[model samples]
Target: MFRLAHISDVHLGPLPAVTYRDLASKRVVGYVNWQRNRRRHMVDALTDTLVADLKASEPGHIAVTGDLVNLALDGEIELARLWLETLGPPHDVSLVPGNHDAYVPGAFGKACRSWSAWMSGDGEEGPVSRDTFPYLRVRENIALIGVSTARATAPFMASGFFREGQAARLEKILEETAGRGLCRVVMIHHPPVRGAVSQHKRLFGVGRFQKAMRRCGAELILHGHSHLPSLYHLDGAGGKIPVVGVAAAGQAPGGSHPAAQYNLLDIDGGKGDWRIRLTRRGLTGTALPLADLEAVELSGKAAAFVRN
Candidate 1:
């Protein structure tokens, strides 16, 4: 069985010093919000503990869906790179950016440059850019597709965009991967399903995304950005595909958002008869040990049994 661990919206904290120029644009709003609210809840220590627990589980691979940094400041981006190194090497970890990584107009490009190793496709080399997304990485019998929905948005809005160009490319990738008889796992920062998040935080072009899924199905879809532990399904050419979201990895226990958590997916079998078991684990409180919260069989003859 291939064990894949999923984590997202880490929002790595302990804000780096910000210059006046950094605060001149939309970052000022994020800076203010972090100071007033986020800093209290997004604790670095919590993320550290969560990562340690995840590593102990020894997943065959790890998928981080985004929001690695808070303000997308140059310092924050650098710190995030260091954090990624501690998490695992590029071969073992795959990442996609989130809205916070592209908080300003050019921040996403900077992040791409710094985090090229984790985001690049197999055998892909040279400088990574924003356009390099929807990259493919094959591990064992699974095909991991990284899609980018992250973009700069206006202050107070956390929306993401899925343009037609990317949608077309995604459909092609899905088709090719399916033809290979590999389990296709698509990763995006924003949940593609409608109503997964509020209006200001919604992923635009939901119709286009659904259309692509209908044309070329995926085995599993993983996303972050809502900071809520959620599960949903989308219609696929073959059957229902599971879409999952997890809470922020850095969120503190007893905070406004759900506590830090990650999903461990055990995938076995092949092509037309895959078996998937999902085990959800995370913190229930500050003093309690990390523990299993839910376990369900996502595929096979049994119906999906999910708790919250």
Candidate 2:
């Protein structure tokens, strides 16, 4: 079985500690709010639990969907490498960059440079050549494609895109790799399809992404940037292709609530079927399955029965 684990929004490092310079400006209130409420929510603690639980699960592959850093700091990128190392090597682990990863000028570029120097692992730098779609790590019967949507934008905008360049390259990859019986797994930090949650947060090129994926056909897509559990199906890929969004593996700048969860995707290689199980990595280093969460499958696609 081609088992995989998916985690996202692991905003590692200590809780945000900030001092406001303006007393009456809204920024000051934001700083106070962060200190009072958000700073107390250390979702990164879930990473510890997740690492332990993942080791126990022993997934064949892992895909992380970005937001690895909190403030786009250089130190934060280093912290992301450390956190990713705890998961495993780059050959087994795959990742994409989120909006937060590119918040500052040339932040993504600098982080990429540093990660290549330190924790780029076995990650290939490109499938698009210009550094937008860095398709890497094709092993066994799977093609893991990672795209970069990280970009610096206005303070109010937190959107991502692959635009024409990356999207076209991805289409070519999918087409060239088709009928090879290779399970295609696309990874991005932003959701490529619109749904109920798209009301407030969404990827800028979601429609285009959908069009491309429909044209080329993908087995599954992994995403983050929305710190909630979401699963949906799209129209283009013959059968329903699943897109999943994982919860934060690190603390969020909100409260001390249980906003820490991730997904374990088990794909039976022989059967060509996949199932996703959601779990919450608790403080005591336990992976507890979220109650009532169901494993979804496309019509006529059966999951390998694993009797526990």
Candidate 3:
């Protein structure tokens, strides 16, 4: 069995000193929000503990679904790179960006340059950029596809975009990977399903995303932006595709949002008969140890899938 651990929205804390120039644009609003609200709930110590527990599980691979930084500051981006190293080497960890990573017009590009190693596809070399989306990485019988929905938005807006160009490319990748009999696992920063988040934070062009999936299909879908543990399904050509979201990895216990958590997926079997067991583990409270909260067994073919 291949054990894949999923974590997202670390939002590495202890905000690095920000210069006046750093907050010239949309970042000013983000900076104020972090200081007034975010810093209190998203703790670095909590994130550290969660990462330690995740490493102990010894999964075959790890998937990080973005929002690694709070303000997309240069310092924060560098700090996040160091944090990613602690999780695992680039080859063992795959990442996609979130809206906060692209908080400003040029911030996303900087993040892509710094975190390229963990986002590049197998055998992809040289400087990686924003255009390198829908990248493919093959591990054992699984095909991990990284899609980028992250984009810069106006102040107070936290939306993602799924353009037609990326959608077309994704469909091709899904079809090709499915033909290889590999379990296709698509990773995006935003939940593709509608109503996953509020209007200002929703994923725009979701119809294009759904259309692509319905044509080619995927074994499993993982996302992060909502910072809430959620499970939704999409109608795919083969069957129902499972789309899942997890809480922020740095969220403190007893926060307004769900506490920090990660999903451990055990994947076994082959193409048409794949079995995925999702085990969610995280902090229940400030005094308790990280523990398993729930488990659900999912099947590649939706008709035979079971939920509990």
Candidate 4:
């Protein structure tokens, strides 16, 4: 089985000393929000502990969905580069950006530059940049596709959008990859399912995404934005496509949200005969290091099963 670990919204922090210039744009609002709430919930110490446990498990590949930096500050993105190092080399880890990574226009560019290695496509020869999307990375019997819905928005908005270009390209990628008989897993930072999240944080073109997958279906999808462990399905070429979401990897206990958590997907089989399973692991209580939250066999085709 190809073992993969999934985590998101680590929101790594210990905000660097910021000058007024850094907060001139939309960051001013984000800065205020960080001081008020984000700082409390997103704890780097907790993130380190959780990642330590994850590394001990030695997952074959790691998928960190997004929000590695809380404010997308210049310093934060740089820090994220170092954080990416602690995880492993680019080839071992796959990542996608989140709204915070694109908190502002320039910050998004910075993040792209800093994390390009983690997003480069398979056999990519050119200098990797943000312009490339629907990047394909083939691992064993699975084809991991990365999509970017990350974009800067006005204050109080955490929405994501998938343009027609990405939608069309993604459809083509899915169609071509499936012909090769690989289990396709699409990764984005936002939930692409309708009604999966609240209005302000919703993906604007979820229908366009669903439409693409409907025409050229995939085996699974992974996303992070809601800060909750969520599992949903969408009808695909042969059966239902599983869309899974994970809560923040750095969030501490004592809040409306759960403690730092992540998912382990055990995938085996090939093409139409794939057998996939999931294990949810996270901090169970204040003193608990890491505990298995749930485990179950996912439907090879359509039906269902999951714990928490």
Candidate 5:
């Protein structure tokens, strides 16, 4: 079995000193919110403990579904680059940015440059200067597809966007990978089903996303902008595509949101048939080991929701 771990919305913190210029735009409100409330909830200590436990399990590959920084400050991007190295080398980890990672007009480019190695395509001959998704990383028998729904918006907006061009390219990638009998797993920052999140925080291209999947097909989908642990499925041409949303990896317990958690997926089989076992390890009051959480098995090709 190929063991893969999924974590998202790390939101690395302790805001670096900001100049009036840095907070001159919509970021000023974000800075105020961070000082007033976010500092209390999203703590680095919680993230440190979670990372230690995550590394101990030692999965073959890790998928980080973004929000690595809060305000997308220049310093935050650099700090997050170091943080990504601590997770694992670029080859071992695949990442897609979330809304927070794209939190301003020009911050997305900086974030991409900092995390480029972790987001490159397997076919690339050399290192990428900037990230262009949906990038494909074909590992073992699984095709890891990284899509970006991360886009900066105005104040009070936490939305994501995936344009038509990206959708068309993603469909082609899905077709090629599926034809190779690989389990195609698409990772993005925003949920891609109707009613997955509030309107303001939703993926504007959910309809386009579903349309692309309906045309092609993928075995699984993973996203993290909502900061909630949720499971939704799409009836794809090949079978049901499972779309899962993970809570913020650094979030503490007993708040309006769920505690920090991550999912480990054990996938096996090939071609027309694939089997997957999902294990969710998380922190309630204290952190739990991998064996502590219940495991759900996805057996047979089309029956993704079956717990078995």
Candidate 6:
């Protein structure tokens, strides 16, 4: 059995500073307004609450899908590192980058150039350089495949790609590791399977990406970008693989809604079968299971959703 804590879209910061472009369409002119007008202080309180809750519910591993920073500011990256440190250590935590983490060309360039130096710390092991793609982490019975989809998106295009090269590398890695029979968990910033928001630029190559995952079996696909909690069951070439999406860690709900959110995936094995307990962050600080959320589960996976 493996317990994993999944979080995303922290958007760490020294708030109320800079006019930066967002990964989505259009230039966001008001960082100050976003912080002041949108109940940003609620987000801060939610962050502190979430962190405290994570400490109480300790998990074997932590997976952060992306958007650790708002503007990709250097200072914000450091702030992100501090936030990760709070989880435990880099070895205990795994991460991929989101579009917001590399909102512009320069941020990607910097991350590529100093990939190791930037993420340097005690007990942290990962791709030492930008050239290293399809980074695989094998821990206990879990095999985590972390991919980089953070790129300099165009003005109107928020999509991401692994391209042919990265995709081929991933295939080889999966083929090699399949015989191990470990639970394969794939982490990416963008959601691959289609949804109401699938037509957006953030999922440009979603069809191709889904095809690739089907070719090389994936147990669970975890991602963040839409800021809404989602779980989709992909019924195709590889039986049923679930794609779980988490909301922004600290972004306040636009109206009367939850201020913070996360996902807790509890997997237990018995009689050689695996059962998953999927919980969504609720508005009243309750961890609501998908079985109770007929509106959220929306598909075949709902039958398998367990309340815990």
- Candidate 4's C-alpha runs over 4 A off are 301-308
Write the number of the candidate with greater lDDT, choosing between 2 and 3: 3
TM-score of each: 0.97, 0.80, 0.96, 0.97, 0.94, 0.80
Count of steric clashes across candidates, in order: 0, 7, 0, 0, 0, 1
Off by over 4 Å in 3: 300-308
Question: What TM-score does structure 2 among the candidates reach?
Answer: 0.80
lDDT of 3 by residue, 1-308 (tens): 99999999999989888899888899999988998888899998888888899999999999999899988999999999998898899999999999988889888999999999999999989777756788999999999999999989999999999998888889988988988999999999999999999999999989999999899989899999999988899999889999989999989876789998999999999978888998888987775579888788777544333333
Q: Judge candidate 1 against the unseen true structure and give its global Cα lDDT, from 0 to 1.
A: 0.91
Error of 3 at 128 (Å): 1.8
Comparison by lDDT, 1 against 5, better one = 1
lDDT of 1 by residue, 162-237 (tens): 9988898899899999999999999999999999899999999889999898889998999999998888889888
Q: Rate the local accuracy (lDDT) of all candidates.
A: 0.91, 0.64, 0.90, 0.87, 0.84, 0.64
Residue lDDT tens for model 4, 1-308: 89989999988888999899888888899899889888898888888888888888888899889888878888899999999999889998999999999998877888888899998898886665556887999988889999999999998899999989999889889999999999888999999988888999999898999889888999889999989888888878777888888879988888778889998888899878888787888988786679888876765655456455
Worst 10 residues of 5 by lDDT: 299-308
lDDT tens digits by residue: candidate 6, 190-248 = 88766635454456666667777778876677888877777776653446778888767
Ranking by lDDT: 1, 3, 4, 5, 2, 6
Worst 10 residues of 6 by lDDT: 289-298
User: What is candidate 1's TM-score against the reference?
Assistant: 0.97
Best by TM-score: 1
lDDT per residue as tens, model 5, 56-156: 87888999998999899999999999999999998999998888888998888888778888988886755443236889998899999999988889999
Q: What TM-score does candidate 3 reach?
A: 0.96
Clash pairs for candidate 2? 38-253, 38-254, 42-251, 43-250, 43-251, 44-250, 44-251
Model 5: lDDT of residue 204: 89
Candidate 2 wrongly placed segments (more than 4 Å): 15-37, 117-132, 196-200, 251-258, 269-293, 298-308
Q: Largest lDDT belongs to which candidate?
A: 1
